[model samples]
Target: MTDTPTTLVTATGDSAGKTAITVALARLAADQDSSVGYMKPKGTRLQSNVGKTLDQDPMLAREVLGLDAEMHQMEPVVYSPTFVEGAIRGTEDSEALRNRIREEYDDIAADHDQVFVEGGGSWTTGGVVDLTDVDVAELLNANVVLVAEYGSPNDLDDVLAAADAFGDRLAGVVFNKVSDDAFESLDQDGIPFLESKGVTVFGALPYEKELAGVTVGELADELGAELLTDASTDAFVERFLVGAMGGDEALRYFRRARDAAVITGGDRADVQTAALD
Candidate 1:
């Protein structure tokens, strides 16, 4: 086991902003003059680059942190469809993959003061290959910082479950994308409740539209919609409003939103014009 401290930032569920938290923590460490390194041992979001399959999150981390390590060292296992199928068919060598992840982690740990390992969509992800977030944390002897999106007070149950799953290795839990109303309640009530249960609450981050929004390009890709205009696709859309109301009401609704997208039919010229306006 490496003496260097490592953190595994995982989420309670899908779209819980694990990557965001990991990146934020890495940036904070870097700002404090600490040599920070990042990794995603079992990557599910795969992208092809230079004839090699790579994980997108690690690539973003590598660029953001200005890390000198190569992509292979940052993401040792690309959990693509083929890789999963191999695991299912017993064609993939699980031990070999685990070894590769450890070797890569050691390589990164050797050069940095701290290493941040981002997990997959959820805590239980990668069970087929025996490399769930908890599994990796145990493999690297890492402290786990589980990120969760706050929906209600009941979400604390999930945190407790994670604490049980991670046991003493759980460093803390962070509530992300919390709404304005939920923020005060979580800060006052939720934090104390979890702390009473011996679970540390790192923070309850209020929801920020800019941070939660999806890029227009990503939205288009997910919806399979072709762009008809030359609008900048990089722009983010935090909310989606249907243009079923009158033009004036639609305009009023649009004005209230920070970064939003309007969904309407082509024949509704009034709504379309209002949206454009």
Candidate 2:
């Protein structure tokens, strides 16, 4: 492993905003005049680009961070169906894969003062290939920064469990997508409680609806939907509603929504008209 400081941004559960935290940390480091690099050792979300299969998160991070490393080095192992099947069938060589990831990471570390590695789904992800977030952190000799999304008090259990899993390698935890009440509770009670247990609470971020929103084009792409109107596809959609009720009811529901898309049958022109109205 290299002497350059490396940090693995992992999560307590799925969709825990690992990429967002990684990007944010990298940007912060860059703003401090530090050379920052990024990587996602095992990519779970696959997307095809120009006949090449790649992980979508790392691709977006590279563009957002403006890193010069090639995409292949940033995401070394993609957990495609074939790769998973081979691992299950005991046909893939785990050691060789690990070596490749290390080599790529070393290359990145050679030129940068800090390298931020974003973990797949969660800490236990990639167990099939023996490349979980914990495993990758140990392999790279990197410290862990676990990101957890707070829904209730029960979520603290997940953070404690992850702290146990990472041991001293875990630097701290960041609570993301927290509600107003939850944020106050965490600040007043939760942070002290976790610190008493030897787990550091870095920060609790308040929930921002706009940050969680998706563009209309992304929604259409996810649903394989066709746009029938000339409206801007770049508009951000914060939520969605179903227009299955009467025209008045649908209109009332639609009116209450902010930047939301309505889903209904194509034959129901009344519902469509209500949504439009």
Highest TM-score scorer: 2
lDDT for each residue of candidate 1 in 72-188, tens digit (9 for 90 to 100):
888888888777777899998879988999999999999899999999879998899898999999999899999997778998888888889999999999988899988888888
Model 2: runs farther than 4 Å from truth? 48-52, 214-277
Over 4 Å off, model 1: 48-52, 214-236, 239-277
- Deviation from native of the Cα of residue 239 in model 1, angstroms: 8.1
Note each model's CA RMSD in angstroms.
Answer: 7.3, 6.0
- Model 2 TM: 0.79
Overall lDDT per candidate, in order of appearance: 0.88, 0.89
Q: List the residue pairs that clash in candidate 1.
A: none
TM-score, predicted candidate 1 vs. hidden true structure: 0.77
Query: lDDT tens string, model 2, 1-277?
Result: 7899999999998887899889999999999999999999988778742234798899899899998899889989877777777789998788998999999999999999999999998899888888999899999999999999886677889999999999999999999899887887788888889999999989988988768799999889998988888988998897778878988888888887888878899898999998889
